[model samples]
Target: MAERPVEADTEAAGIRDVQAQTRAWAALWRRSSPSSVVHVDATALSDGTGQDADDRRRSVRDALASAGAPARDRDLIDDILAEPTGAAGPCSRFLVVAEGEQLVNSVLSRPTVPGEIVAYTAVPDLLPLLLDRRGDALYLVVEAGREGGEIHVLRASQPSALRRTDVQGRADSLNKVQAGGWSHSRYQHHSEEIWKQNQTLLAAAVDGLVRELRPRFVVLAGDLRAVQLLSDEFSPGARAISSTVQTHVRAAGSSRGALDEHVAHTLGKLRKADESAAVDRLAAGDFENGAVGVGAVIHALQQGQVDTVLLDLEAIGPRTLFALAAGPWVASAPEEALGAPVLDSVPAAVALARAALVSDSRLMFVAPDRLPERAGVAAVLRWPTGPAVPGTPRWTQTP
Candidate 1:
């Protein structure tokens, strides 16, 4: 399979887009008879030389063959194998095989982690990878000045310039006039006015971006004055999402490696803090709108009450959960089947993931240590579950 190179586009993808894609893949998986799905997670950056790349491709091909991929899908395999490797940043690729065709192929960056290969009955279990790749913040680098400035927007560590403009304003030399005492002061005032005007322009741009992107966090880096002024311009909503880094825009550009390291560190901290908070809330016995076990999470998901389903990845292995093709419910036993007919017992994680997607809920793969419950699964509800108690023992019965 020769890997195909996928161009990284600048357009940001929203949650709705992810949901829609998941639904589409789910549908494809359901329709393909004997869906020969093959998932290969390999490094886009090769460790050695050309031989290493060849070895990588051969390994992927061998894996695909072992996964029972039909020979008719060779072209698709080739495309997947040929994807450009050795990019400066982290890269991950996903290919979905179904209906004897390559339905979806995407090369992603960030979360530059190790890779693996998996062959599932129908759809590839992509939920964890997707969740891991999800962006937690939007980085906006703005150049300071009244005359010219550049705005670069980075989501999920992928950078793209969103806006650039020349902000005509008073020059510094105008404020440097000597011996023209009163005139110097007047020029200084003029320079201040120009700076204010520039700030207003930048503010308007930032406001529009904030409304459009609606990112979880807004990271601002550049001139201190510009950063402060832009921060002031943010709406209450934007202000709530904004954060700042000390690095200047030019310095960040010159040393992208350092900037990325800083961004990663900051985001890592934020993610850990968030996971802790969610775990705390779940453990608070506030079972009204949250669940602490697999059974409860399944029940909430069935009722479309789940807003975010959290899983302790370590606790969940290749366990299977019976679910239907068209419903957002999963059961540990056949006797617990809901209204929909049983499709198959999919990987527990995949079953939960499909259910979440069907209900338009988010999925979070949490570390085992962070989870308060040893049950391996939990969920945050969109609405309170009222008197409904989860994991009541009866729900786990075979009959």
Candidate 2:
């Protein structure tokens, strides 16, 4: 959930800062995006009576065949089972692991898209390795032992880096100036030439690396001039989104390494702050204050008091609110309506407010508290009239 949607703050330097903008974008989407990676492993069940070892392996293979493991790994599993293990008690045993084709196919069958690596390891020892390998998604490791003739599901963990930031470098910018004298002209010409040269150098470096490494994103850390140069050259391809980031070092490789650390820390901080803010907003009576609360907002609509609606991007089910009149409301969930130009959640609310500059109705987001009270769901209302106009029951701004 978001308190407010897409907001941009332009600094004096002509730099645009979008805070909590993407949150709504994610929420306003129509479908759930899958995770980055999915890990899987295969093991055979053991029967206490050693006679059925081959049967147990066959059963395990059959189950895996239903899942999407690779033919090669499947062959490998068969080979391993056929080979004799010296430490065997009375039964036979085997384990299998695959990452490239088999794991991918298995995950694709599922509903979501995983973003990171999916590994299959026999033991947790690989946990550290998986985490090091851009570990950012869901991990499912299947541990099967020949326990009474049947295999079983063991343990699963979604090990996160606790720090994964998509790093990108940016540098281009524009500004409007009132100065138009000979001095300004000369300065502009000199500045433009210098900037162009720097851009050319950085562009070459970035383009070369991109061609070779093919990294998802690049984080450039150098002098401000050089950074901007790269931004201008790369902006055409939309290869990366650039931002003004601080780096203590200046060397290319070293700077990129330093940037990894900085970005990870920064993203962690941002995520934590976002979470805290969300919790607080939900706790506060924002829901009741605006059309945020499900019930009151709905009631307001039935009474024709709700001129507009402020929807949360993370909210669920458009069917829940179809009873309300058709007007501009912020979209909170990532689902699309059958027919509506849905704005990203919080952004939708803000846009409605801006549009109110002309229309009789206004739009705004409701606080979390009001969400439950108005909707009749289990939620707290921060205040009674937060969403209502000062002297009227109608809400003009998002709570």
Question: Local distance difference test, per candidate?
Answer: 0.61, 0.34
lDDT of 1 by residue, 372-393 (tens): 4455778877766565456662
What TM-score does candidate 2 reach?
A: 0.27
Off by over 4 Å in 2: 1-192, 196-220, 228-255, 286-399
Give me the candidate number with maximum lDDT: 1
Tell me the deviation in Å of residue 157 in model 2: 17
Query: Model 1 — which ten-residue stretch has the worst lDDT?
Result: 1-10
Show how many residue pairs clash in every candidate, following the order shown. 13, 40
Tell me how far the alpha carbon of residue 129 in candidate 1 is from the true structure, in angstroms, after superposition.
Answer: 2.7
Error of 2 at 179 (Å): 33
